[model samples]
Target: MRYIASQIGRSIRIVALSLPLADARDVSQWLGCNANASFNFHPSVRPLPLSLHIQGFNISHAASRFAAMTKPIYNAVVRHAGSKPCAVFVPSRRWARLLAADLLALAAAQKRPGRFLHARPDLVQPFLKRLSDKVRNYVIPAQNRVPSY
Candidate 1:
């Protein structure tokens, strides 16, 4: 991410609301900028709520907390982001499959039809397609780097 930012030029303006303070500071340090560097485009820093903390799919604590919520993850996501595309990140192939199954179970129960995109779809089995017909088996990975403007 810092490499991509440097390519555009130094001093990237970041809105790190979705990031923990450690992550925010790391990003700043990697970019050769002071952590206190502020940009007018940035919103005042505030703590993110639980729902946005889904980056680690294999985290039993996070998953369990999410599971215990009165609103299912699927419903909360669909409600908060109504029809908009949503992205959930998971580390590793095993966690990806497990998280996919958990999400699909919820979606299936709700009878929600949606597309599943895989950067390396060939790596997954045919069973994944059964979850959704509009699945894109292969897609070039999107650049997740923060931009400097």
Candidate 2:
């Protein structure tokens, strides 16, 4: 598209959307965009805006780091998401399950045990029953508070 736009000379206007990159100016130059025509907004600049919070844990052990982050993650979700839908990404399925369990425990402690869970146990019970024994052992107790995927 850049080549085509460049070949078209000044007759056509070229517009591009991209992730913020260090070489944005070079890219704009390659695309034949003048300084006035080129725009490189920061990654945090979004149409709807975004709230970001970053915390670093100095814990050296992976398990300790993960355990330490669970409470903060739960607090962030409660503060930012409120009743809105939110998603949390983890490096692995193991961490995902562990974080989920920890988050549930946190909610339970606050007397909002089912705050982040789906209310449809009828739909979830059969699915839970089909899980492997190892999974069932961890999931059964929280069946009523199963996180909604």
Candidate 3:
């Protein structure tokens, strides 16, 4: 995490969303807070708390074709990761539907044996009731809010 001075007299915690692999040193030197933050550039170790977010997919429904297109991406991701892997993000109801559809497509594309891993959320209950059971279980629950008068 990085910190920056705030106009409201609070320190803001910052984390870079992503940076090019080539500019790693410059980003750390400039954004890192400690004097010896330079040592973070060492090549031998993996970094902690990395996050990846893919956005802008319609969340209400997942179609068969879209699911087919995404199967390769998911397969590639799985092949690159370590064993005992877990996914942290939640997809909207639409995404869940899409993912389910995608998985079906994946199953169709390949004629051999397969294993499925579903996404899971840390939170158990959600405020919204209209979402599907799969989505509700897999996503961070929304907070119930009273409308202002």
Among the numbered candidates, top lDDT falls to 2
Better of 2 and 3 by TM-score: 2
Candidates, ranked, TM-score: 2, 1, 3
2 or 3: which has the higher lDDT?
Answer: 2
Higher-lDDT candidate of 1 and 3: 1
Q: Which lDDT tens digits does candidate 3 get at residues 56-79?
A: 445445454455547555565456
List lDDT for all candidates, in order: 0.47, 0.71, 0.45
* Candidates sorted on lDDT, descending: 2, 1, 3
Model 3 residue pairs with clashes? 59-94, 60-94, 61-94, 62-98, 67-102
Question: How many Å off is the CA of 115 in candidate 3?
Answer: 1.3
lDDT of 1 by residue, 17-46 (tens): 443343555656665667468332222344
After superposing candidate 3, which stretches have Cα over 4 Å from the reference? Answer: 1-4, 9-69, 81-114, 117-149
Q: Candidate 1: worst 10 consecutive residues by lDDT?
A: 137-146
Worst 10 residues of 3 by lDDT: 140-149
How do all models score by TM-score? 0.37, 0.52, 0.31
Q: In model 3, what is the error at residue 34, expressed in angstroms?
A: 5.1
